[model samples]
Target: MIIKEYRIILPISMEEYPIAHSYTTTAVIRQDLALGDDIEISKSEPVTNIRLPDGKRTSGHFVHKVYHLRRQVPKWAKVLAPKELLVLHEKTWNAFPYSRTEFSNPEFLKEKLSLRLDSICAPDRGTSENIHCLTPAELAQREIIYLDIAGEQIPRKEYKAECDPKIYRSTRTGRGPLVGDWQHSVSPVMCCYKLMTMDFKWLGLQDKVEKYAYEAERKVFCQFYRQMFCWIDQWYGLTQADVRAMEEDTCRQSCSRANRPQGLFGSKSAVLLPARAARLVPESKSLSLPLDPSTGF
Candidate 1:
């Protein structure tokens, strides 16, 4: 298994991040739908009773989203990869200030592959020691990376001037235009310490796929938080009820676009087709891994 810890510092406070996160995620879902990618929210409900590892009780929300990326795959890989392999199942347990998300492929890859993320939001400068309570063995193998939202260089293809932190200033709260040495000067700074563990047990593809997962996680973090800061004007001043109502409206719209029944809160779709083991073997050199969504961050 590959273990990585990504620390991302943002200008928002811990109290206000949940609203911004939900609002931005809803917007991202719509954008994905517009790009011909289908997302099914298999389950979404409120969790009022959650027992933490420290034996403390808390309340939070739960959401399960399955991503369909048939259109995003290369044509050649489609011939070798099965329909089931094209989908990713995500279950997120979000208790603000702390959350855990798991991503898995179909049943066939249950033992061959696995991914889990644990995040802790704090008001410090990424100085927490073992925030996720990782084991000694896990800590020895873990890689820590600090993601500078205002300074990190993303791919040119994914860059947007509107999302650039150096150019965009927030109209609400006035926290924008993060210039040099902003981490020391930014007021009300918080860090999302995210721990990602992934393992792909394929014979020839295990190493490459594990390395790719780290990069994928990093990309998702930088992109999501950059947009989170840039879109502050829209989500800033929103309450919990306000965000929940927006989520409901987005769910209805998603159902309409998917042409499926609405309000299937606890339903799981049996849409993946089973394929033979031989058909699952693809040319490793030409295979590209799908990017997981930014959930529970």
Candidate 2:
């Protein structure tokens, strides 16, 4: 069966299913991964062809990553806890989807797994000075950076240019390079283009930049359905009992609808009885009327 792929996303659908609908082909790639759909991943073949805002077409690559998430969240992950008492597994991309370790002692998991939740959420927007325990809202805004399939490294020249020491000192605002999902599905590529551009300056983009930037920051985000750390996918929270119930429901609903053979129509047949030479009957002392007209009393 063929699933329709659209070059441009429809506006009507975005308004209807904003959470689920995505224009980024990577979203489809994520879906394929999440559902465990049959797909052949090769380092040679790009995941999907993406059309840049300037009509330049490029292909993206998939970076396979794995994380061992706890089947059950730690009891205190919900409550307020000390920074030293918690541990996060961190994500392959250091972005939206991630898992953490569950331990009464935070340092224990780190020492055992050599893992810890990233200290900074974003370079520009770091966590509180005292604590780095990221909230679900904070995690949603994180980005999963993907390298280009062709191995074409896009550079941030604006931040990297050499400044004239004699004239002035250049000050950098962002803590480091751009991170996270820059052009993932359901996202508009125009923003990524703007971020990755050279010294080109344009007006009428402040509102748009702010708007797209916030959209890029996923609040209350989950990719459990599409990847290792799906936050809100129905299957993410499914238990053994839930699986059994689903299997039983599926069996009950399944039925064959094949057509049955029609019954043949035929004419009615006549019935005949053998004629008797003599009637053998015992006469009753009490006279009784014959019930049938053909029978003689």
Candidate that would win on TM-score: 1
Least well predicted 10-residue stretch by lDDT in candidate 2:
277-286
Question: For each candidate, what TM-score against the reference?
Answer: 0.83, 0.16
Scored against the true structure, residue 149 in model 2 reaches a CA lDDT of 17
Model 1 lDDT per residue over 1-297, tens place: 888888888888877776777677655554554554555555655666755545577876666667675764556547766777877777776666677777888744766778888777889889887887877998999999989998999789978999999988987788879999888789888988888888888887678667766775677678778888999999999876786676566656656655766554334532111111101111100010011123343
State the weakest 10-residue window (summed lDDT) of model 1.
281-290
Of the candidates shown, which would achieve the greatest lDDT relative to the real structure? Answer: 1
CA error at residue 256 for candidate 1, angstroms:
1.1
Off by over 4 Å in 1: 47-59, 72-80, 264-294
Residue pairs with colliding backbones in model 1 are none
lDDT of 2 by residue, 1-297 (tens): 001100111111211121221111122222222222111101111233433323444443222111122211234432533443333321111111111111112353333322212211112211222223334654454343322211222245512122111122213211111123322432212111001110112245334433432332211011111111121233333444554444333222221111212111111111111111000110100011110001000
